[model samples]
Target: MSRRIPLPPPPPPAEIQSWPDREARLVDRALAMDELGRRLLGGRRLTLFLVWFVLLELGWSFVGVALTAFDHGQIDPITLMLVMFSTCVGLAILVPAVWMTVRGILRDRVARERLAQWAALDSHPATDARLRAPTLGLCWLLLSFAMCAVGLWISFAVPAGTSREDGGYGFVAYGMGIGLILWITGLVGLTKAVGHYRFAVRLTGRPGPRSASSGHPRPE
Candidate 1:
């Protein structure tokens, strides 16, 4: 006589499994942490760049004051032209250079966040590929600025022919010529860099994974 065997307790229901739910909770928590990290990093990066920018501006102001003292009232037409030309070039280059650097830094931060997201997923590709353009632009701008600064210094050092000569034309001409060339080269590089960044943004989408989404489960 076989005793009536009690059926084994039925497997837990889907909702009771707890694993998926727990996983979802963990994912939510990780995402939150990732967002916080991004915000912190972004703020720090911007602060650093801002400080650098202020320093650059201060140096430029000092140089302008010195130039004014040296050439006050007795400006050479040729030197004036060079100064005007260099000023134009500097303005043109500076706007985009700062823009590209800031943009690149932001992209880099996004890439880092993507990396953190990938760690949880089944597959995660590196975002470094997206950085190529911005990085290139940054390098080009830095090089161009350095070259221009050097040219300006050299212009000041050239011998003056007479007391009437402020050496402005010679200084301005050589400095502006070198600066213009560098600015043109930087612009070309900046264009290429921007294209690369756009392509990367299209591929990965801006603010990926960590993007704002209420559907994302809340962390436990």
Candidate 2:
């Protein structure tokens, strides 16, 4: 299902702004959330994960081949070897990746809570637009899906239609791999963006004396 993402109010008018030193520092700390999002979604760790994911795919392919061989009554030493090899290889990579993914998600959930609170605040008008805008997330989501569709087409259609002599399968596999990586990355980005937006909307809706009314610049 599609979700309705809440946007922060438009960039407040630019004007001379002043705040207590402590509040300014808090605001700066809060603004650091933008840097955090960029690192999490568009940084080296994501690249590392993408590279690691290919091995997971390779392991799955081995398992699939083993199962196919067993189904075709090719049960022998080779089949036994494939099964044992796939099982060992799969667990070797799968366990650590799963653990890392779960740990990252839990930590991010807590960080997202903080981001939502900061986003809900009425910060000084001069704050960077990245904080208020979900454009980066949306771009990642759309690009990922588009690339994934392209990958699916390449994986199935190109290999099936092309003659073996043409050797299109290798290229197709490359495209498919990239698409899969982007799709996973996009899913993670979407989750972070949506979670933050929902919490921000809820926080903004609640009744309270916001810092804006206190006659000082908003706190981070």
Candidate 3:
């Protein structure tokens, strides 16, 4: 006992608590809740976009049918060919444009959600994914337009036979119809793939930075 000072009493458990640790736990919980809310809203937005897409397609189809019926008699071979080409080009552009717009909206929403999550947790993986639907959609649009151009070239270069028996304009019409159908099917598939990717990202909390890139979950 060589003049040892009396040991101080042990500190209370509460006194030993770390404020930073408590705050971090609170922040993590808040972030998880925020992410949940954001996902809920994202789901609603996705549903609305889908409904809008359906309505737009239905309206456009009805109008196209009406116009064709009204002008069927007045459309000559050249005019018919032009109409077919125009319709293809219009669809090629329209589908992508709509997809891009929808993607932009969804992207903004996701960004906002991510920001909120970041604010709470102060942690997020750096991401360069800007809504790329527009870019990819544009690429597809250009490809479809190019295909339509090729069809147009074929239509003009293929000589209209002197005799109606040679199937003059009918052959061109049939070819145009088939090409249009194929083009539309391709676009539809592309859009569906995009939608599937989006859903997967949302469901799995994966970051899809590009159209083809796969997102992986953060390890627990």
Candidate 4:
């Protein structure tokens, strides 16, 4: 059987002075932790899947619009059934997306706590500048905001066609659907990066903690 949780990252150095690119090394080690790895949900692979799904959802709306003949304002029973089925398939993607988002949030919280403990072991502590919100996280947040804007513009401002009589492929609702997926994925990414940074920052400048029994960082 496949393992449920990812393998935890190798231990970070108790003192970072010897490590080259100290901050990057710290981040790499933290991300290797099982919780962070799982929260990514396969990382870039999941991101690619979301992009494909968003495109599929956007196009499916057009399919639905095509199935209905607006000349007489009447719809065929078989066409309506087919359209409904297609729509159901498209919406089903949301189930997994929602699960990932919620699971990621919870996992990030755990990763943050663990990361703090791990960082606290370093004798040469990180500085506040080194612990600021991660750059990748800011990108996630900014991209999400852009997507939200585009989704709104497409839904409300962009004209579907010369006339709204035939619905012009229902771009409004479709854009919003695409936007929702991007928003969820981006939010999760940002949460992980920002949370990790925050946890590390909080421990900066503090004296290293040691267990009574062992001088090393505790195991997960």
Candidate 5:
């Protein structure tokens, strides 16, 4: 006896006709969705990051001042304890600040690339102004200036021979040390912040939908 083999039929004509267009549309939708998601998510994160930065800076300044005050009296156990606590907090804040600064700077670069991609795709112009300007960079610049000023003032205020034993200098020597450190760090921060700002401005062109003077977004 002879055996017969059956061949499977091809897909319907309608299925073939619809597949390519459907797939293309799906891809487009996915890409658009992804861009939107990233924009929204990035904006929220950036805002939160800035707020945390401001709070930390304020806290650090206060702690530093308090430590300087303690240094004037005596290097007692309590003073030592407070100094240690302040140092620990400063170190802790510094770790996260540095991490966030680097992260934000990298994210800014990524955002520039994203803008390029959008332009290439002829997507809608992003109305979110946060992406256009280096907000964190500006904050860093302002903070750096303030820190440098404070450091200079402290340095000038510290007299020679201010020692803990005589309770005359209180924390003058320590103040000078901290002041110098702050000044150096402030200069470094300013340089990096300026670089970031310039790069961001170049990438985004004119500041998006917002005007820089008023710090508010225009009607989109």
Candidate 6:
């Protein structure tokens, strides 16, 4: 009979050496939450700046138009033509810059929310569905905004003489239609991100350190 040699007490249950390293990483991530939130929400001021810029541009455009109307006889034809060209060029540049800024702000907010969701999970790991919800929403937001921007730019570039029957005009129209759909989808995505953030905060029972310093009052 083979002596039932008790398998050497199972080598004292191989100690999980990874727990300390994982815990340390989690701690570091938690600490970074406040800074991340600050960065994420920092773009609010940029949005305000864009609004002011748009108003300023509109005001300037109106003033130029008014002056041109009254000074038609006094102003040289060549000088008036140059002024109009400059205004058009400036407007083209400004529109694209505004779109870029908006897209950037949306992306930043999405990233910040993702980080907050992660930090919240340290104590309360929610369902996988909930975990992915905000990400999907934010992705939609980003993609839709990009599509809308691209479509608008393309439409703007289409020549004035190009008829609807022309391929360029058709392409621009198609792009605009697709962009509209994406814009709607983006709204849905934003709702998902907001809902997920609220849910995650509830799971953790309070805002993390990031939220505390962000100065935005916690959702009631």
Would you list the C-alpha lDDT of every candidate in the order shown?
Answer: 0.42, 0.50, 0.42, 0.48, 0.50, 0.44
Predicted candidate 5, C-alpha RMSD: 15.7
lDDT per residue for candidate 2 within 139-165, as digits (tens), equals 545654554566556556655665545
Task: Report the number of clashing residue pairs per model.
Answer: 0, 0, 0, 0, 4, 1
In TM-score terms, which candidate is top?
A: 2
Q: What does candidate 1's lDDT look like per residue over 1-103, in tens digits? A: 2443321222233345443644564454345434433332334433444444543344343334335434556668776776666556555555655565566
Q: Estimate each model's TM-score.
A: 0.29, 0.55, 0.31, 0.53, 0.42, 0.37
**Which regions in candidate 2 have their CA more than 4 angstroms from the true location?**
1-23, 120-122, 132-139, 147-186, 193-209, 212-220
Q: lDDT tens string, model 5, 81-194? A: 777877777767766765665665565455444433332322223432333345555666787788789878877777554555644443665567567756765665566456
For model 3, give the 10-residue run with minimal summed lDDT. 211-220
Give the lDDT of residue 97 in candidate 6.
48
Which regions of candidate 6 are displaced past 4 Å?
1-23, 43-76, 124-220
Candidate 2: C-alpha RMSD to true structure equals 10.5
Model 2 error, position 197 (Å): 6.6
Using TM-score as the measure, name the better of candidate 1 and candidate 2.
Answer: 2
Superposed by TM-score, candidate 6 places the C-alpha of residue 159 at a distance from the truth, in angstroms, of 30
TM-score of predicted structure 2: 0.55
Superposition error at 218 for model 6 (Å): 14
Q: For every candidate structure, what is the RMSD over all alpha carbons to the true structure, in angstroms?
A: 18.8, 10.5, 18.9, 8.1, 15.7, 17.8
Clashes of 3: 0
Give the per-residue lDDT digits (tens) of candidate 6, residues 1-118: 2442221111111243242554564554444543344333334433443353454345344334433343334667877777677567655655664564466557555554555444
Worst 10 residues of 2 by lDDT: 5-14
Winner on TM-score between 2 and 4 is 2
Q: What is candidate 6's CA lDDT for residue 187? A: 47
Error of 6 at 55 (Å): 8.9
Off by over 4 Å in 3: 1-29, 36-42, 74-113, 116-220
